[model samples]
Target: MNDQVELVAQAIYEAEHGVCLWEGEPARHKERFREYARNAIELLDEDIGVLLLALQEANAGARLRRSKGSVRRDPN
Candidate 1:
């Protein structure tokens, strides 16, 4: 969980906070970072799902949120 969180933070920083320093065509850079951010979001969501399952198993009464009609909600 810790590793996953750190990885997500690093990716988000690279996508958003690090952009000003990158010397490249703006549109291209934005597209690239968008992809990176999307991937990182997927990773973070998966990691959170794993942790949520662990919590549910350990504490049977614990309940996680649900997505509208889907089965899960993001930890964020």
Candidate 2:
């Protein structure tokens, strides 16, 4: 991947893995990811193609990437 893609993925990994101060600490980053994922799904559904298909594709792609041990680095 290009530099921009790598950077964006690094940013996402940082966001998903937030800071923790102590043992058994609650992760505050998941909430942000959930919120952002929801908003993205909503906005894309409204402006792009069908929601169901988008969600299906997202799920399938996620599964494939995970199974292949390949992290998705966006070109954003």
In the range 1-76, model 1's lDDT, one tens digit per residue, is: 4444433443454446754243344766555655665565576675666654544463333222223346666889
Tens digits of per-residue lDDT, candidate 2, 4-76, equal 2322333344455663222343456444444555555555565534644544475467568777877666889
Clashes of each: 0, 0
Which parts of model 1 have CA positions greater than 4 angstroms off?
A: 1-25, 46-76
TM-score of each: 0.31, 0.31
Model 2 sits at a Cα RMSD from the real structure of: 13.2
**CA lDDT of every candidate:** 0.49, 0.46
Candidate 2, lDDT over the whole model: 0.46
Candidate 1 positional error at 16, Å: 9.7
Candidate 2: residue 46 Cα off by (Å) = 6.6
RMSD, one per candidate, in order: 13.6, 13.2
For model 1, the local distance difference test gives 0.49
Model 1 — TM-score against the truth? Answer: 0.31
